[model samples]
Target: MHQYQFSLVFFTVLTQWALGSILMISLYRAATGGQELNNSKLTAIALWLICGFGSLCSLAHLGNPLQGYYALRGLGSSWMSREVIVFGGINGLTTLWLLTHLVKGKENLQQTLGLITGVCGLAAITMTGQIYYAVEHQPSWHTPLTHIGFVSTALLLGLATLALVLRQSSKEMPAGFRALLTASVVMVFAVTWQLAQITGLELNGVLVWYRVFASLMVGCGLLVMAKSLNLHSTAMVGLAVLLMVSGEIAGRMGFYGSVLGKMPW
Candidate 1:
């Protein structure tokens, strides 16, 4: 894998995680009747920091960071350009929402802004997935599965991160929330396995190690989450997040490694 690939993997995964966090946090607020404004503010700050770091990783992928503005010029035809635009929109909207929350302290307007930010974040995730799905030369990447995998990664990482952050804020987990999260993880893994079968790619390669490690880590994380719920241990939630994030990083590495572009030979 090239250095650019690594940078891209981090950029996409981190940004998606940020996006997912925002969306999940919004849902959490709504589900809990919007009582925890202070906790929500902290969560927004953490997500913004994640987005900032992801943006920096994207810059690392560039040959000349100063010319990065040129990427926005191709928005008429390039998915990459659209991805940048969408991400910018997501960041901008989120910032505006954060400011509104801080200055105005109006829950109604803040909730509205949160909804819009979540929509933009979801669009950013779609555009990120489309960047790879539009690659005609890479058969391994040009598929619906790529989009599904991207969304799944976002949800998995987003929920795990949210769980940890909320726990830190001393927020109680809503009833059935843990069960819902676990089911989502299981469903995503099942779909990913099915997609692998559909692609019919050989499972015997260096990439297989990444896949196996990711699976084991994610599985362990889910088990840990379940145990945490049973024992009511907030610390275990943090551990679960760590495991899930590491697993996702490994899975994304495999995702990049699986690319098999058309050969001139």
Candidate 2:
């Protein structure tokens, strides 16, 4: 991948990771009825930092970072523009929600903001997928599988990340965390299978299998170990995250590779 595509890999993966983590955090809270966990402040700060970095990666992908603001001009029509706008909103809302957490007795406001941000984050991820799905001539990217793959990747990465965060407080697993982890793994497997079926002549066979092995097989294996061993340390979960992230990056490369050589311009 070239410089811009490299930027996109981090842009999509990291942003989605941040979005997914916060969403799960909120869900976990709701499921457990406002159970407090250690390192909550640190998690918020880390997510904010990730969002900031992801935004910068997006700007770099524009080729002229200084002129990236012009991308907003197309909000009336372009999915790219809409993505930028929605992400901006997500960032702002996330900041406010983080601020709420800094204060005491704001549980109600914090939960509300978190839920809203989570919903908006979903829309932003959708827009990111739509940017590729809108290419009418690119059969590989035009499929609905593109959208499914993006969302599933986000959830998988998010769930893995949340597990790491929660592990910081207690090695003991949370009630819903295991269920979400299982669901995320299933979603990723489903997306990979569908992508394999739909992606013909667009991606290399070897690369596709590499992604399946690295992301689906190895990553899932690590997750299984973490769950089965009931390991409290971040070691197993951390490795799982690394493999899963790498897989998502490879998948994105294939997603772009399908259309890169065929650009009309």
Candidate 3:
């Protein structure tokens, strides 16, 4: 992989993680009729900060950071340009959503902002996936499986991290939350299986396997243990989050490596 591509790996993964977190939290809030989550303000602030950090990583990925805005000039024809615009919009919306949480008597406005942010986030993430999927030179990334894998990463990373965040105050995991956790884990395997079918297992690298082990094996194992033991230890959940995040990062590295290292130049 190109040395500079690591910045992109962080950029894409972190942005998707934040988008997913915001989406999931928004959906949960909707399901519970805007029931306020414990520490929601803190969560929103953390997510907004994460978006800022991811944006910085994205700028770093551009060797000439000052020229980064020039990328927007391609908005009419480039998926990357669209991605830049959409992500920027989502970041602004996230800030507004976060601000709504800061003031009292803004639950209605907060929920509205959250839902709007979630919708824009989905579009931004799709644009991110499209950037890779449109790269015809990288067969590994050109497949629809690429889109699925990217979305799955967002869901899995977001769900796992949110579990850790919410578990901070709850004594036991809610059934609904557990079910989402299980569903996200299932998404991890489903995407992996799809990738094997799309591009044979042999083409997958050690980093890919590490991703599988970390996100699916160790991460899910911790969740299962928590359920079976009826425990909500932040330590266990936090460890799971760490493993899943690292796993996704490794997986993303494998993603770019497949294109840069194996392509016939």
lDDT of 1 at 164: 70
List the candidates' TM-scores in order.
0.82, 0.88, 0.91
**Cα lDDT tens digits for candidate 3, 88-165:** 888899989998988888767887787788778767877788988898866778887777777888888777766776
Which candidate, 2 or 3, would have the higher TM-score against the true structure? 3
Off by over 4 Å in 1: 1-4, 104-107, 169-172, 175-180, 198-231, 260-265
Candidate with more favorable, higher lDDT: 2 or 3: 3
lDDT of 1: 0.68
lDDT of all predictions: 0.68, 0.77, 0.79
RMSD of each: 3.3, 2.6, 2.2
Off by over 4 Å in 3: 1-4, 171-177, 197-204
lDDT of 1 by residue, 1-265 (tens): 2622778878888887877777777777778787564456666777788887887898898999999999989978999998887777777887877776667656576666776777677767777778888887666578777777777777777777667767667676566666666665775676456655644446323444444455345444554445555743556765666666666676676567566322332
* Best first by TM-score, ranked: 3, 2, 1
- Model 2, 32-139: lDDT tens per residue? 787787888888888888877987888877767888889889988899998888888899998988887787877578767877887788778988999988888767
Instruction: Report residue 84 deviation for candidate 2 (angstroms).
Output: 1.6
Residue 22, model 2, lDDT: 83
